[model samples]
Target: MFYLPALLISGVPLKEKIVLRKLTTLTMLLWLPLTAQAFCGFYVAKADTSLYNQASQVVIVRKEDKTVLSLMNDYQGDLKDFALVIPVPQVLQQGQIHIGDAKLFEHLDNFSAPRLVEYHDQDPCQPMVAYAMAPGSDAMTKYKSDRIADRKGLGVTVEAEYTVGEYDIVILSAKESDGLETWLTSNGYKIPPGASVALEPYIKQGLKFFVAKVNLAEQSKTQLKFLRPLQFAFESPKFMLPIRLGMINAKGPQELIVYALTEKGRVEANNYQTIKLPSNLDIPVFVKNEFSDFYKAMFDVQVNKHKLSAVFTEYFWNMGWCDPCAAEPLAPAELKQLGVFWLSPEQFSGAGLPVQITRMHLRYTADSFPEDLMFQETGDTQNFQGRYVLRHPWQGKPEQCEAAQTYFKQLHERHVQEAKTLAELTGWDLANIRQKMDLKDQSSTQTQDKQWWKSLW
Candidate 1:
């Protein structure tokens, strides 16, 4: 005879005596069924945490002798937690089913279709039920022959049951063309087509509409219009400024107007005042119909060879600033009398040499010259007599010079490696010996060169 366990402590006679009395009564009253009804048949209902939380719903089914027993609805409680508990039925031999909420059932459709069935063509309708073992019933060993068939086909009929809040959900699944009779008979759950319940209105309304309407009104403002061409110029012999075309009140449907400005002079008939004007401009105009199409249509206008060289030379000269120590002093007489005058040379005789070398020596030693070296006496008067000397003769050990040369060679190799890496990373031929590199500007080129050199160590 078995009853719910009770605890007894040693040396507690009074509490032990009360427990003994309750245990004797429970044994006499409940022990008979515990022993004799162990062989009786029953079905068990197990709930999953997915069924407990509000995230998803579940459907349970008996694996054999499909029979719907109960339906549980909105099982997701306030705590958003769930536990699996097997509820044993008094009639142990009966089979039952459980149905999850609408969302979970639909999700299961993607994994295994034959295992789930719909009732009344309703997505969230009552889930059908089938045979399942009773709680702690050892049915896995005793009823081994009751497993369902694993039929493989495009579609197959199955009986499923769900328990939703005290309701019994029964469903049958089959292919679309098969009549209800064939489906019900195949799955062993036969409810006449006329007896089936109609689908709920809410279920029908929940079906998503495949076709959607998009409003074009929001896109209307994106429509762009073209305006008259505007002209500007990049000054000759120094084309640093880019030619610009001004657009006003431009909207969408973007269009491009490219016009080449020809340098010309405007003349006033009466005053003979000549003003510069642009002429003979050949402009291409087109509307861009697509995002990709617009960028592809753009092309660079290369200035003529003569124009480019002239611009390059002018730009280089403007950047050149060399000190001329031969130039006469320009200080005030008071400053000259005080021997505070300094003069700069007015001429240089080198070409193709790096400009950095010319500025280095003067910048480093301008304030360190001796006063006697810069001044000389002519009879009774003092005259300016400064002499500038530039010397860079190699005068170190051969090994020392070899070390410096090796250092520079290593730096150059590192630059080559970095260029190779950049080329590989960006798929741009940054250092291909045969190809001309397209540097952004002189500063960018210097930065890249410096960074590559610094990485050698």
Candidate 2:
């Protein structure tokens, strides 16, 4: 017989989506460095001219000191009033900045988000064979110079300034946090309360500030409902992300999801704990209809269980392909679109570029996360996904034969175990979940009145 991988399944289009337009900025500050997808940073404030809110997504592709970073937020506020403050290890030139596709982030998110799959158990009464399965899966602003006298007076230098897409970009260097804060407010970018306190550290580290705001006129021309992602590329020895700035005035904890791609291996946090998200458990079939709600509730339980102090890797797999693909391996073109600078023309042989992707998530407050996210690409190449399972048992009646009776006995036992597993993972009441499972539908469950020898037929 011809052999095929039992896990082989056609690519399924993503059904659950977190609409980008539905997101709001709450007052999130973030920063990241270059290695693969090197650096990221942001600050959110309550004022009209500032970005505020939770849940930001970033993609970092890094190798050594070279990095390509993409920053995205769901800022539904007025474009004219929006502003971004990020940190950089070096000055960014006009060529180093570009506008990225928002759809790409959605695609990556869909492809990497936790997945739910189902299996049909063959009747154990019949002879059966089992087979093994396999699996897999920003631009800087420009600064202006002619205002040297004005900038100098504030002890800040506008390194470069130019229009990139819909953003007015400015790269700035300051001698002190106070001077930088003074320069930013004077230039129409509102520095949030206590910004100088947060800016002091990056300043002392000799990092430059990247400031970007949407130009309303340019934004109108794009004819898009949301801001396109911002791309930044540069070389630096650091492999980390800055999150302290985002915490400056945040009302509560913020969530960030990172899609890190590398040619070497999986990417994970170094300073904070990096552990795998729970996976491969048999859950109630009802989860199929409410996977999104199930995932969110499950994730919340996990966060609380860890006391909101850990980073969870949701998916980590080689990029060549997937067994049960959430979506197809991102095409080479898509990778390039997100700033995978290492894939040269000659490198695109019959074999695809050797890239590994790790999706990590965390929620942090000023107290829970005190330092920026530091990362290291690990040598571990094992493939993993946040996959949950639902197995539909054979429904044959126990009166059919002795095998059927035995199968029924097993089914009843399996249902009990499955309920226990679901309760363990989600904290839902086992009895409640069992009721929802509708055990009344099963003949095995209905046959509790039969004698033990009768169950053997």
Candidate 3:
């Protein structure tokens, strides 16, 4: 029974308010137009974070040394029982903390989610044409006089405390993991049994713990049912996320989806094998009905293939546009709400900002992911997505024309290959796939035409 993990903490805020110069990739602009003219497909479905029950979503907007990290809470327990403890590189001041809108995260998830797209095959007799495009609250209490002395004795210092939105946040610098865990437990935080072990690494590295709890009184004022995400802005040279603390009390493997918005092209895990998930595969049209299951099964296969140690990049593209958009490109104002701090006020009324988003997914356990995830932004502007294609075969009769006959003959081969691809991807039984497609067998494709079109006038 894992709750929302202490997924992110680190960075300093730029004091001088350095205006980030917008840098657009010329190559991306040149090829961007081609996307609208080349791929003629309609987005049918998406595999968003909602697919995983225990998935935790985090949004990290980074530029140079500045970062805005947002953590989504999916805790389904007593509000009082919910708590978060993360290690930050520096003490986050009151001004640095923020309560973000949950809708922004949803928008990010939907926009970057892996999509299932469908393209109706063009008539064999007619020339092909080009088509275009698409697009928590918490509260906290004070320690008694004796407890305050005891905390000092344990080498625990509360650097700063604030009630940001409905959350009561405390920044603490600690000397030892055991003492930190002891102080947290004594202070009413439910410290899991093995938390001290996880806290040791972060504590040893001189990181400060940013703790938060629900302020039920404040929360009631908002009249919202669920807790909103907590965000913080800071500056630091380290590009990493602390996921180790999240594994302490997890029931099993936990899902984590990171939406990284950066000024450059794409983000990849610096220390782990970052590979793109299998994409742009031609799959049986039946997948349109069961895409959710197919995506889950395919992801499970990928997790096993990588031994649950790799970071899978699901989508990487510029925020301005999408080739076959799962959702419309995020507007500039929405991007700012998600912590794209560099966007000037003037840019909000015009076109979208120069932001590239990289969506990475991982299913991790403590043993498999021993280190916190370190990240690096690469200059690779090439766009990629976990896009599965479904081509509805032309419904015209095979005997209508010579071209129609040839189309059917080749369509049979395509169906066989599609079945093979689906079987390989999802590890589902090939026979079941063929059965669903009405394919008798791979050896005979002509006998099983999809649509029963009698003739064409």
Return the number of clashes found in candidate 1: 40
Tens digits of per-residue lDDT for model 3 on 276-328? Answer: 99987889989876676778788889999999999999999889876555666
How many clashes show up per model? Answer: 40, 42, 14
lDDT scores in order: 0.19, 0.71, 0.71
- Model 3 regions lying over 4 Å from their true place: 1-53, 130-150, 348-352, 443-457
Give residue 249's lDDT in candidate 2 (0 to 100): 61
**Model 2 C-alpha lDDT per residue in residues 65-137, reported as the tens digit of each score:** 8999898876655666667789998899999999988877866776676776665565566545333432322
Worst 10 residues of 2 by lDDT: 18-27
**Runs in model 1 with CA error above 4 Å?**
1-213, 218-407, 426-457
lDDT of 1 by residue, 176-205 (tens): 323332333343432223211211111122
Q: Which stretch of 10 consecutive residues in model 1 shows the poorest summed lDDT?
A: 357-366
Task: Name the lDDT value of residue 438 in candidate 3.
Answer: 91
Ranking by TM-score: 2, 3, 1
Question: On a 0 to 100 scale, what is the lDDT of residue 161 in model 2?
Answer: 86
On TM-score, the leading prediction is 2
